[model samples]
Target: MSNFLLQLSYLIGSITFIVGLKQLSSPDSARKGNLVAAFGMVLAIIGTILFHEHDGNKIGNIPWILGAMALGTVVGWMMAMKVKMTAMPQMVSFFNGMGGACAAIISIVEFNSHPDGAPGYLLVVFLGLIIGTVSFSGSIIAYGKLDDKIKDISSKALTYFNLLLLLAIFVVLGIAVASPEVFGHDVVWLLLGLSAAYGVLFVMPIGGADMPVVISLLNSFTGMAAAFGGFLYNNPVMLTGGILVGSAGTILTVLMCNAMNRSLLNVIIGSFGGGGASGKGADGEQVVKEISVTDTAILCAYAGKVTIVPGYGLAVAQAQHICHDLEKKLEDKGVEVSFAIHPVAGRMPGHMNVLLAEADVPYPKLVEMEDANPGMSSTDVVIVVGANDVVNPAAENDPSSPIYGMPVLKVWEAKNVIVMKRSMRAGYAGIENELFFHPKTKMLFGDAKDTLGKLVAEIKEL
Candidate 1:
């Protein structure tokens, strides 16, 4: 009866997982999908704890596992609470690293348990080890650059170096795994080290603009690693999780490429950053006019209908809540407040929307690019927060910009535009934003969260 109940639970969980994934594909149902997925996870955890019975002879120690879980939970919860929105890209990279590490550890443990080398086990372990190593190291490098812990370095030669390192790791792994006894157990450590080094080298030379694509690609690697581990252990839940992550990551990569009007090959090879044809004028100075925050706020407060655009800067400022507060204040005064969202806004796709949603912003208040475009010309004010590449007018006007053909928010069409940014520096595409220099545009140069709060307070004065 207990066994039957466990099987039944697993069956129910699988169905929920499938349904949840389907629902997640649509924006309208995404929240429900998340809830369903959470429900499924809870069911899976209960079932596993109840059904898993390890004989004392086979599994002598459980304390370490329990302790590790507790430690991880505390760390994860703390990080989640403290991580800023601007640092979300780095946080995601870290998550990818953890996933890969988990897979790599599982592979090592399984290999150690079976020194005789089963063909199926060897293949799974090989795949998991490679993917996990690459994902872990690549993601760390990505995180470092995103967090500004390391400077951006773009080199054509780095690609070739990455290829060579990959080849070397594979060759060494093959040799070590083939003669584990002759090579001794130390070979595993060597293999792990080399593979990890290769992962770091693989991502080191990529520029900041390319980090998003790299992150997505690494996410795929993590998923593949998880899938390999699942096969090694014959765990259906793990397999499903891996496949889901892999598919979602792939789709996100494609979407990001589209956002830049580039292909995967262009992203991988051209290392293209999106910008106008003029790009960086002498000494990396983007040619855009700048203005003061006081003037920008006055412009927004006086506007009839306002559209707010959120980006990583808003997240970093922890200003989504402030934005919400300002929006409510505007609405109270008979202003039509709506948010314009680019599909690929922020460091990752839908990143800005996720931040806004987390702040409990109304779903109806958020509008997509297609829906928002027509309204831009009629909009009295468009407030851009820490947004760069997505709102560039060069994409529409400049033939020479790398992102010339990409669709962007038509903020320039609005009667008045206020952009809240930190500096005159160009976005990831390393190209000047023509919109910044527009006659109707004003720059509110400051921290996003603080500026939004100031605007909210200033609105009270109105």
Candidate 2:
């Protein structure tokens, strides 16, 4: 009877997971979906602790288990509440790394408990160890890069070295499985060290622009590792949860790669961003143009249609609310206002969407890149707020550019474009924007939040 109840709980939990993931496809039901899934998880945990038994013995260590759960809950809640919008990507990487570490530690404990287990059992243990270790180390590196604490270390020799290191990892895995007695207990530690090294080197040279893809890939690795743990323990709920996370992460990674017009292989080996080669303007020389706050307001207020493009700088300045205010004010003046969002716009996937959603912007008002481009030529004015690479013309015009084949927003096709920035510095890709020098483009120099606030005030007075 006890075993039957436990299985029932797992079945309920698995159903909730699927339902929650489906609801997550749209923003309207996302919060409710998350709560439902969390409730299911809690139910499963309670059922397992109360009813699980092995060989007529109930589980022990209740106090320790409950204490650990309480501590982790407090820490996770506090961190989630305190993180800023700009640091969200780093926070995600940090938390995901923790998950990977937990999975890796589980494999270590299991292997140590049964060092001379069957060959098939050892294979599952070894596979979990390798994947989890790599995910943990790689996620940490990705966190460092997103937080701007680490710089890309790109070199042709490093690329070749990484390939060789990967080869060595597989070779070691084969040997460990073929003859577990060759290195005794020491082989496990050796494999751990190699996996960790490969993970670090793998992410060391990847640039900031490719971070979304890396995050997604590492997340899948963690899921795969967790699934292996589920296999080792024969836990149905654990297996279901792990498979869901792994498959979801993989699908998201593929979508991101398609949006960037780059293959998974190219993303791994290209090292496309961070001090890459630059592309010059169409005419090989730049002509400067500038605009004032009053002019920007006047132009936007009287325009028939206006579109706003946001980027990482907008998140850095915490300007999503003020930008939304500007949008509302313009709409009041009989101007049609909407946002243009690129798939890879900010630090992570769906970043810009989340930022705008936080500001209570309606879902219908946020237009995607492919949909927004067709209307660019008819748009009266385009306001680019803290965006850079997404609007740059080099992607279409320059074959020498590293981001040449990647798709970008066609704001240059609009009637007039206003770019907001503090200076003439390059973007995250470390390259100049050819759009800044275009005839229809004008620079509005200032911080995004302050400038947008001024625009809001100016439009109100008109």
Tens digits of per-residue lDDT for model 2, 1-462: 999998899899888888888887777898888988898899889988998887788879999999999999999999999998778998999888888889889989988989988888988899899999999999999999998888888888888998999899888888788888787987889889999998898999988568899999999889889889889988888888888989999999889999888888888887766445575634556676999999999999999999999998899889999999998998888899999999999989789998999899888999999999999999999999999988888889888877888899999999999999988888887788888988999999999999999999999999
lDDT on C-alpha atoms for all candidate structures = 0.79, 0.89
The reply for model 2, stretches above 4 Å from the true place, is: 281-284
TM-score of each: 0.85, 0.96
Local error of candidate 2 at residue 29 (angstroms): 2.7
Error of 2 at 48 (Å): 2.2
lDDT of 1 at 141: 88
Writing each residue's lDDT as its tens digit, candidate 1 over 252-302 gives 888888876778877665555412236436544545566665665666677
